[model samples]
Target: MEVVVNRQDRRKRRLVRLFLRLLLISLVFAAACAVGLLSYTKMQGPPPLNVTQTTVYYGADQSIIGEHHQGENRHWLPISSIDTEVIEATLAVEDRKFYSHFGFDPTRIGAAVLANLKTGSKSQGASTITQQYARNLYLSHDKTWKRKWNELLYSLRLEMNYDKDQILEGYLNTVYYGHGAYGIEAAAQHYFGKTAEQLNLAEASMLAGIPKGPSYYSPLFDLERAKKRQGVVLQSMVATGYLNQIEADEAHLEELTFVQNELDQPSTIGPYFQDTVEKELIQTIGIDQALFEAGGLKIYTTLDPQMQKEAEKWVASEMPDSELQTALVAIDPRTGDVKALVGGKDYTESPYNRATEAKRQPGSSFKPFLYYAALENGYTAATTLLSEETTFTIDEGRGSWSPSNFNDNYADDFITLLQATAFSDNIYAVKTHLLLGTDKLVEVAERVGVESKLKNHPSLALGTSGVSPFEMARAYSAFANGGKRVEPRLIRKIVDSEGEVLFEAEPEMTQVLDPKLAFIMTDLMTGMFDPYLNAHTSVTGGSVSHLVSRPIAGKSGSTSSDSWMVGFTPQLVTSVWVGYDKGNLQKPAEGQIAKRIWAQFTEGALKGQLKKEFPVPAGVVGVKMNPENGLLATEDCPTHRVSYFVEGTEPTKPCPPPAADGQPETEVIDEATKEKENLINRLFRWLGN
Candidate 1:
């Protein structure tokens, strides 16, 4: 009886312990359920509050061009705005069980786990479309259990709060489709130059497959891989009953044709321009936290589609096969608007945008401002200066620095100020800088849009100072716009998604130089290209004559390794630079590419515009001068020989007759001499007066 009682007591104790353990387990599970429910309730409280101001772009005519978002890194359209077929196709291929799942599909998850186990590796995702949306909207793509749990929980909450259409809309807007594209709208426009509403089934399936891994399936990168993925998506659609087998097969077999409109196509647009605008946009509009998290943005840019296309073609064709790169920046001088910009040969290969980012020595391009400074300081075009070889020693406390012209020759023999400038005589420019004072020249450069740090050294006259193409273009606009400096602008105006103006570029034009001085500088630059004035003309007569209708002025520049040409017509100012990425010296073959590109682009860009010569200001006047000597000339002087002068600064005395010896010689009276002498005296007096 005692033994039986002990056995029963032990059994009762064991049963009691087991019951306690079961109760504890139940309580823990209930607590977990309560916590999950609380989390779900928090997530379902509201769609993340976001304020995305769509950027509104305007055409040159001020017409509405396009719109972009801040969050999605691309343009976004409402789910209702897209075609129902597009939505169906996306769901059919990406997540057929999308509408029926609670964010996570148990059956798919089991199958994925089994596949992983069998393959001894993970190869599939169990998250439904709603789960992807949730991950995009709220959770990160971290491959951690914690992130996965959060994704699953938020996805379920999303499904509960939103209908299938709403979930689909959010997913479409938030998914990344590579190439810096965020959502379907951007992807559609980026790849096919169309909207989601216009995509055919084949295109739709191709785009849908991209979300799985954009880089891996990018048609631009690998068409074959993209086609294979697209085929899989088509098969999935058929299997999911979204398409009949025959229809699916036909769609798969159809040629994948992507039409890229100049404006919407990513290939045609300037990648560097896009990068620049994006940087500027980031500063203008703060990235909205919600939209950024959600991932689609409609970015309306200031790029002119036609101009960009032309520029891209010019670079690809004109740029040499060498590693040397080229950059171009074109702007409307009147408004300081950037009309077109090409950063490099290929953005994928190199993201460095030489247009605004790279700082290269401007070479002789810096001479213009020095000349302008000379004009401002009361130096006239006929101002005589010795271009003979000379040297200067810098009183650096420890050592002396001497500068020499590229030609290693001096104008000491006698070269007119105009001739010295025309030839880009390095010695003459340095001497001019010394006479005018380095500080004053630096000040003028700063006023005319040189933002780079300039030293007070004489070498600065030779463009030893580093500067960007954008700055150089802006500076040249002072000459283009008649002395007014227009700050370079990338964005014309910014509007929200609702078409409300968030910001607009109010161009600030400041008179950086006297109109008279600007005209004199332009005149001097024009003479620089005249073969009659410059012994070594950098441009041909055909090129110079082309600028005659419009008062065009330009300066060609060459540094040790970089070549530059900054010039302007009455309407536009363009700057082009060519150099190696490593700042190495360009071979002769590579250097000429920049000049060729500039000539080609300018010819095409000015096709329809009327030839308008640069407007000559009232104080400016032209006078005939001896080509060899910048002095008042007689009828005997070359008719093509001319120099610019401020009315008061014209030559007051006639050039003396050429001397045969150290002493001045008298003219021999002959029939030819008598007639020519009288004509020469009268012409000189008229020019002097």
Candidate 2:
């Protein structure tokens, strides 16, 4: 019995020694891990914020045209500026033990882990206010393990650097609160038409409830959801001791007021144009997205209010909802200044900006590029091409493409390039496109500021590719402005809230087409206006001939679904498009819908301005030629028309009469003398035999 007791004592001592050794090793490992984590947190530093500013846009005349957010509508407010009740409610709902926790609550985290495990999902919330602030300030709201690790490191760093008040202030100011509003100040002004400091208990609690799920609790969008969320916030305040039972009940029943007076939305004068400017502010000029959403910027734009008014009047009067939809864009060809732009029939009924966003086939309006391509490749206005019905085969089993004229009336006779353009001859354009090469045409279109992606096919010559009205107007501006390619300018300059200049803009012009070619194009476009000049065959926009006060040049394009009339003057250029938003377009009354808009706008916008004529530049030769053979004309040439030719490309030879005439105009034979000479010749011939 004594030997067994001693053996048991020895066994117990050995077991106790083994447990102590293992415990010592675990403590050392834990101490090493804690030191490593602390070092990592030090490296993370402070959270950074690159917030967007609010921007105010002005017209060329310095009128308040638009106000838009750069990114998020936010205002950084100190804790003192924010209502105490609002802060209390946020703490209760977001982080209950926020003040006591050192960046994280291990107890809550453990609880969250167990709950998530039970539910078989990672959905139980465990992020403290500091963690949320870290994510909101520096990291994107992604749920990846990498992002989570970064958030943990950033939260620890934030806690180490900033006090509880500073972290809370940062979190409150940076939280997104729907409808472009961010932070407590922006939310207060957006929801209650009051400042953050002036927010009452009811308004503050409601505002605090919104940050949980902004869209779900947006009072303007969902009042019931917002009220329900507001009740939850009041209950949280009661439990957190910020409000007693009586105060919480009264706060819930209190009537909350929202934005009552005129909210500073974009004005009615140019809603579409303003929206477009806001979008392009970031897209084209490459402004930082944060700057755009941050608000508080002053922008000067290229809008002429008088012209905009005239544009709006014409669209509203001409095109009602009963008729087809329309888009109009006017620009200064020389400066690329967008003077007036109307995107749709009514901005109230539809806010979509059709001018800049929508793409529709310009149809024959696209031919100018093809013609420009031909001119560049050594083809003249007098160059003749057969306009008979023709078909060409396509590649890769797509079969053949047979393009038809607007009325399918093929001119079988020889058609001059200028005359064909006036008539918008489809066969003539397709033939020239094929001859000049499809790739060459696409190049000219791109060079002339047609920004939309163009199709590299033969039918592209017929304007089969979809384009916005702005693209058409900009392309036509090249011809009007002596071949200089100028993209439409919306914003002239931008200055941030701190009076720092962010961006300044001017017309960056590139001479894409030759001045001579541009002049010739302007001349060729006259056939569309002049019926008496082209034997009444090319009178396309002749109905508006009486309204045009200045020397104008342009083309008209019509497809089954889209009709376009894009014309320009030496001073100003304009494009008009008409189509149904849905369903194919039908022919408009009186004339094409585009023509009416163009004429109406021209009459109004150009009323007080001087009559501008296209300047005839150097490097061109004008000659009288037979339009039939594209050669120098004689007194009795079949057709006599003065054709301008690019120097050295003009026809050098004179027209020769047909053989039936038998003699030149310089020589003549009388009938009586001819008969006597014939008789004498016959008698002398008989005697010699």
Candidate 3:
């Protein structure tokens, strides 16, 4: 009886000691947790919620051009906006106890530790939804105790500051889904071409499986692997009581039709122009590459969405053949706005951006600048220039310079400067360039906004030097807007998310020529359109001449390799180019391709707008001159034509009377003329032999 009593006493005492020991352990754990909570609470509020949003671009008409998300490819959604199925699937797979836990899930962490110990590697992860968000937000993915500790602290702070719904929504939006998608919305859009609110059970389960191993089971990379992972996610949903076995099985077995991602598709709008906007955005906001992409900037551009669409449509519909390429750029003359720009037929096929980057010879389109320089000098629209086949024996030992007209036949000796332009006479242009020094023409070109290097050689007048369509448009803008150069602008302003104007563009203009002289140049260009004026070729009155309704002036340029039609009205300036990316355009096709494109674009873009006439600036006077001679017109002169002349430049002398037989006088031939005649005779003789 005494031994039994002693044994009972010892058992009771041992039980009491065991209870005390457990109590002590609980107290110590509580103290450690309290210390951790305190430390986390003082951790500077999680380094400022660096949530990245998509930067939106707006056109001049306030329509959304595009949205670009830096590296995340994420679009944020509130918990209320997400589908119930997606939320349930996410809870089942990522954190079943998401609503119950504070920030760290002790049970999950303990299980992860035991699993990791068995594998002798930290491959097993136990981060809850909140903990994962903390890791993604503040800590790096490096597997180390320090990183884990920081993640834990950040998680605790998140729980303290935000509600359960807030934490879960942020986690769902921030976690990575495969194929460069982030957030539930981005994942849904990427996988099923829908929003998070539109996702069904089958798609939700599939997306729920991705954040665990995004690249490992990416649908784009491994479809079978992704399916298997999706099955795992569906089973988890069943086990977690969110779904029944039959429901989970049906969802798992349902054939998933993954719609294509919109980001992967080509833009329906002006993709090339959008690309240019992004490039300019990069230059505008000189920040870290990551920040620039993540800046969530609101960019307002000068693009006219309507004009851009039309330009792209015409370029594609007009130039269907892929062998030949085309680029068209349009600008508002008064504002320097790039209203329409198309670099190629289809941006997806090739995004080389020929409008801004391709440099080819401007051909005869460059003749306007030569005339502008001529007018700035002593020349006038009534000034006569000889457009005959002539040679300059500039260097007897080395070589001689001889310029030929487009047609083998030379013009009358007394063709006025305006008529010379009408026929696109190369001889007349070269003669004018020589009269006004070659260096003077180069200066005029630079002042008119030819950013590319120009040549001072005699061939420069023939546009042997290369220039981009952008340069061509801006240079022509001088004539369009009264002799002032307006720098072409892609973006007008940039604003931040807070409605703060971060940057604004001011119009950069410089007066390069006399307004009257520029108007006279415009007058000379108009002759290229009137068949009566340009009996040789009226590019405007050609097959596509019906497209132009208002008064407009332009030049058609062509070479063995490049073709161009750069034109402008008083309000708009546009330049069009056609050629192979490299090598000569050897195919024998229509010569009017460039002219036709210009006519179509001008007619379409100017539709529905008020007709604007080119205002003749002051100090410009009109005079009726004989097309045969640069003299005041009389009834006796043959084919009298009206010409614009700068006030002081018009001739005061009246034209001489016609010969009694109404025929021209025979003139003595000089050595240069005789040499040209001999060269022509020898060419015919060689052909005959």
Number of the top TM-score candidate: 3
Per-residue C-alpha lDDT of model 3 across residues 501-620, encoded as one tens digit per residue: 877887788888889889889888877887766544443334555679988888888788998899999878989999988888866453467777888889889898888878888767
- What local lDDT does model 2 show for residue 125? 69
Predictions in order: lDDT:
0.72, 0.80, 0.80
- lDDT digits (tens) for residues 389-469 of candidate 2: 777766645888888776667666666787787888888888777756689989999999988999898889888899999
TM-score each candidate.
Answer: 0.68, 0.60, 0.77
Q: Write the per-residue lDDT of candidate 1 for residues 362-419, one digit (tens) a residue.
A: 8888889998887766566765555545557554555555666655655454556677
Off by over 4 Å in 1: 1-44, 47-75, 84-165, 171-193, 199-268, 282-295, 305-325, 343-346, 393-412, 494-502, 534-551, 580-593, 638-642, 652-689
In model 3, state the lDDT of residue 187: 85
Candidate 3 residue 503 C-alpha distance from true site, Å: 2.6
> Worst ten-residue run, lDDT, model 2?
663-672
Stretches of candidate 2 exceeding 4 Å from the true structure: 1-54, 69-266, 286-290, 393-400, 534-536, 588-591, 625-642, 652-689
The residue-level lDDT of candidate 3 at 44 comes to 56
